[model samples]
Target: MIRTRFAPSPNGLLHLGHAYAAIVAHDLARQHGGEFLLRIEDIDAARSRTELAEAMIEDLRWLGLHWDGPVVWQSTRLGSYGAAADRLRAMGLLYPCRCTRADIAAAATDHGPDGLIYPGTCRGRDVDPAGAAWRLDMARAVEIAGPLVWEDELAGPQHATPEIFGDIVLLRKEAPASYHLAATLDDAADGITLVTRGADLFAASHVHRLLQALLDLPVPRWHHHGLIVEGDGRKLAKRRGSPSLADMRRDGADGRALADALRHALLPAGLSLTTGIGWTT
Candidate 1:
């Protein structure tokens, strides 16, 4: 069975871009007679709002979508992520790094896919574990995992080169697990055989594939689909103050008609979709 998921963080309202992504994932499963899962990625409790989460759920429902099972909340699975981190630690694949954002910005002389490539300033340092983040020893991890590859349905077969991101944090100083660790483990646990997400996160799949190999997690084929963008070509994002689904509803838009139009690619004026990988990292 082709199991897929729509995992959204509850930090902001669901916008048109989110609606498009959700429709893609929901249809991929339903059309294939498979299961569609919903996961509330609320691990960052400080930023994740319960009200926004509720509103998003209602919005998804209003959009005429359904899931096969109960939703999974990331905040409830901290222990599982912690255990995975412990396994990596035992394998000597993880190291404690006490570097803060300011420290990294000051020390990093190179940039990678996601932004500043972390310089290994804490690799040999006797960093205190009390307030340190657990970073994956990328070089050592790649060596252990050996040459790797993961395929995307749209992009075809490709090599997994996670070194571009440098040593990524698996466990945060304030949180139990980073996005990479938590999402990888959650997909496996949820039995998601196909991962559907935005093209913006296409680079992230490389790091995820590496984590799968290192942790012995199941490899899921990915579909990094087109993104919905506004007239200015900026992606419709919550941070950018895009009008949300709830906003649309409050303005008296018909929910089912909107969903139907999206399904048929009848987007509003000045909004469009593109398969272009917006960024490399």
Candidate 2:
């Protein structure tokens, strides 16, 4: 059976981009008669507000997207991520790096879609534990495993060689689990067979695929839908003044309008302003 999830970061309001993702995942699961799951990716507690997290759930439901089972919160699942990191550590795929953001920016030779890839300054450096941050050893990762492949629905096939996102951080300097690690563990644990999210996360799928190989989990099929762009041709973001679903609902806009807007965003070539697609409230 097909199983999927909508893992929102809970860092911002559920905007048009979020609604499109939720609707796509919900529709995909329903079309296949699969289980739809919800996972709160609240690893960044500093930015993940309780109100925003609650709003995410409420907004998703208001969009008529019903999920199965209780929601999974990443903050509470740190131990599992830690254990996975430990497993990678034992396999010699992990090492401690004391490199800061400045250190990486200075060491960058070329940049990819994920920005200045880590320079591996501390690749084989000894870990002081108190001073070192952990980074995945890319050279070792490449030697141990070849390029990670992801079968995408929209973009077709893609791969992320270790050379791209070199030795990514499974654990940070603060030692909290990063999104890449947490997402891989949780998606597999939730048995998510398919993943539908924004095309902006297209590179992220590669990162997640690498994690899947490292963790020995089954990789899920990916469908990276298009983004909701603004008049300036920029993707929608909270910083960009995209209206939140909560704000829209407060202004008497319902899920139908949200769905219509999402559809318009996706298929702009064949746009139609219909609000009666399959929802009422």
Candidate 3:
């Protein structure tokens, strides 16, 4: 049986972008007689709000999406993430990182697909783990995992090049696990057969694919859909002041009607959809 999930962080409200993503995941599962699941990515305790998560659930419900099982929260799966991190540490695939964003920007001499690549300043440092994050030794990890590949339902076959991310963080000092580690494990734990998300995160699949190989986790096919954008082609975002589904619900909009319209590529005025990444507003 096929399984897909819509995992949203509870740090903010759900916008049209989220609705479209959810619809894609939910409809894909329903059309294939598969299961659709919901997950609250609340690992960032400082930003995660219960009231926001409650409202997020209400928004999805109002948008005519109902998952097959109870919602999963990242906060509850810390133990599993810890175990994975321990395994990587034992394999000498992880190192303590004490470099902060500012420190990295100053030391970084190269750039990668993800952004300003870390210069590996803390790679050989005897950093105190008390306040340090855990970063994957990308070179060592790739060597062990060897040449690998993954497939996307839409984009087809892809060569796994997680090195583009350049020694990404696996465990953060403030959080139990980074998105790459937590989401990958969660999908496997929940038996998600297919991962559906936005094209904006398409590059992230490479990292996730590598994590799967390193952790000996199941590799699932991915379908990276497009993002809902604005009149200026900026990807819809909460920080961009995009219209939220919650606001529409509060105004008594028809949920099912909105969903059907979304299915047909109908969007609110001054907004559009784009399969490619758009600039920030």
Candidate 4:
């Protein structure tokens, strides 16, 4: 059975972009007689708000998207992520990095698709593991995993080249697991067969595919849909004060109608959908 999930962080309210993504995932599952799951990515305890999560759930329900079974919270899966990290460390594919963002920017000579690539400053450093963030040795990992390819529903087949992101952090100092580690593990744990989200994360999928191989997790096909942007051509984001679904609900907007409009590409005033990998609106 195909299983798709809409994992949302509870750091802020759900906006139109989130609603559209959730609807796409939900509709895909329902149309194919598959299971639609919901996951609360609340690993960032410092910024994660319980109230926001509750509101998000309410908003999803109000938008007529019902998920199967109870919601899975990432905060409760720290041990699993830690064990996976330990396994990678044991394989000599993981290293402790004490370099901060400032350190990397100062030493970085080249930039990849995912910002400045780390100059491997702490690759061979004998830093204490407990006080430093853990980074995956991308070159070593790819070598061990051998050649890999992942399928995308829209983009078709894709070659996995995780080195584009350089050494990715599996575990951050502030969070138990980084997005790459946590999401990859959770998808496998939940038996997800299809991963669907915005196209903005298409590049990140390369990193996730590498993690799946390193952890020996099940590989699932991906579908990176387009992003919803405002009239200014900027993608709708909570941090940018984009109008939220909750606010729309409070203002008596018809949730079902709005969802239908989004499905048919008939967006509201000042909002448009940009398809493909790069969202240049």
Candidate 5:
């Protein structure tokens, strides 16, 4: 059976862009007679708000998107991520890194899809793994995994080139696991057969593919749908002060109508949906 998930961080209110993505994932599963799951990516305990997560559930339900089973919370699964990191550490694919963001920014010479590519400042350093951030030795990891390729529902076959991300942190100094590690493990654990999200995250899939190989997890196809953007072409984001669905609900906007419009690609006035990997809107 096909399984797709909509995992959203509970750091802010859900916006129209989030609504579009959720609707797509939910509809795809329903169309195929598959299971649609919801996950609360609340690993960032410092910024993760329980209230916000609760509100997101309300909003998703309001949007008429029904998910299967109980919600999975990342915060409750720290031990799994830690054990995966430990396995990588035992394989010598992970190294302790004491470099801060400032340290990386100061030494970075090139930028990749995910911001500055991390320079191996502490790759072979005599730093203690405990209490220090752990980074994957991408070069060595690729060597172990050998050549790899992943499939996308829309983009077709993609050659995995994780070196573009350089050495990525698997475990952060302040968090149990980074997004790459956590999401990869979570998807496999939940038996997600199809990964769906916005095109902005299409690049991150490269790093995820590597993680899946290194961790010996099941590979799932991806569908990176286009983003919902404003007239200025900027993707709707909470950080950018995008109008949230909660605000729209408070203003009495019809949730069912909104879902229908998004389903048909008939976005609200001044909002547009960009096409996915191999398709046009």
Candidate 6:
């Protein structure tokens, strides 16, 4: 059975872009006769709001996407992530670096596709464990692991070597679990066989795959769908508030119209979509 997940961080309101991403994941599972599961990526407690989570659930249901299993919350799984980090630490794949934002900005002299590329200034530098930031030692990781390759249904095959994201922060100085660590841990634990989300995360997939290798977990299939662009060509997100489905509801957009717009916006070229296509939201 193909198991897939829609893990959204409840940091803000669900926008049209989020709906598009959700629909793609849910519909793919239904089309494949697989299970669709929901996982709350609320590890960043400071930004994740309970109200937003409730609103997201209501929005997803309103959009007609039903998921199986009780939702998994990332905040509740710190021990698991910590254990995984510990395993990497034991293998000497992790190191303690007390680099702050200022330190990184000052040290990061090169720019890459993902913006300021880490210069690995603290790669082999020694620091006090109590005062240092915890970073994944990518140099050691590459020596232990080789190149990682994964296929995307839409974007085709993707490959990455450790040289891209050198020794990223697994745990921040404040000891909070970063997005890469939490996402990898949850995806592996949930038995997700497929992951469908927006194309913006395409580059980050490499980082996630690296984590999978480091943790010895099964890698899942990836499908990065096209993003929903706003009139200004900027990607729609909660911060932008591109008139959410709830806003549409207030304006009497109804489920059918919302579905129609989403279908027109997301369907691949040459594919025909109609109201009878069984769209839930």
**Model 5 Cα lDDT, one tens digit per residue, 157-229:** 9999889989998899877899999999999999999999999888889999988988899999999999988
Per-residue lDDT of model 2, residues 147-200, tens digit only: 678787666677665466767787886637876787788889889999887676
Alpha-carbon RMSD, candidate 3: 2.6
TM values, all candidates: 0.96, 0.89, 0.96, 0.97, 0.97, 0.88
The residue ranges of model 6 lying beyond 4 angstroms of the native Cα positions read: 266-281
Runs of candidate 1 with Cα error greater than 4 angstroms are 278-281
Local distance difference test, each candidate: 0.90, 0.77, 0.90, 0.91, 0.91, 0.76
lDDT for each residue of candidate 6 in 1-281, tens digit (9 for 90 to 100): 78888888887787777787788888888888999999998877678899889888888887778998898887889899889888988998888876667877888977654667777776777767886668887777876778779777766687766457777888876546787888888888999899887777777788888888878899999877776665455676667555666676556656655765685665333322222111222
Q: How far is candidate 2 from the true structure (C-alpha RMSD, Å)?
A: 5.2
> Candidate 3: minimum summed lDDT over ten consecutive residues — where?
272-281
Runs with alpha carbons beyond 4 Å of true place in candidate 4: 278-281
Report the CA-based lDDT of candidate 5 relative to the real structure.
Answer: 0.91
Query: What's the true lDDT of residue 218 in model 2?
Result: 95
Model 6: worst 10 consecutive residues (lDDT sum)? 272-281
* Order of the predicted models by lDDT, top scorer first: 4, 5, 3, 1, 2, 6
RMSD of each predicted structure:
2.2, 5.2, 2.6, 1.7, 1.2, 5.2
Per-residue CA lDDT of model 1 for 128-213, tens digit only, reads 88878989999999999999999888888889999999999988876778989999999999999999998888999999999999
Clashes of 6: 4
Model 4 / residue 201 / CA error / Å: 0.5
- Count backbone clashes in candidate 2: 0
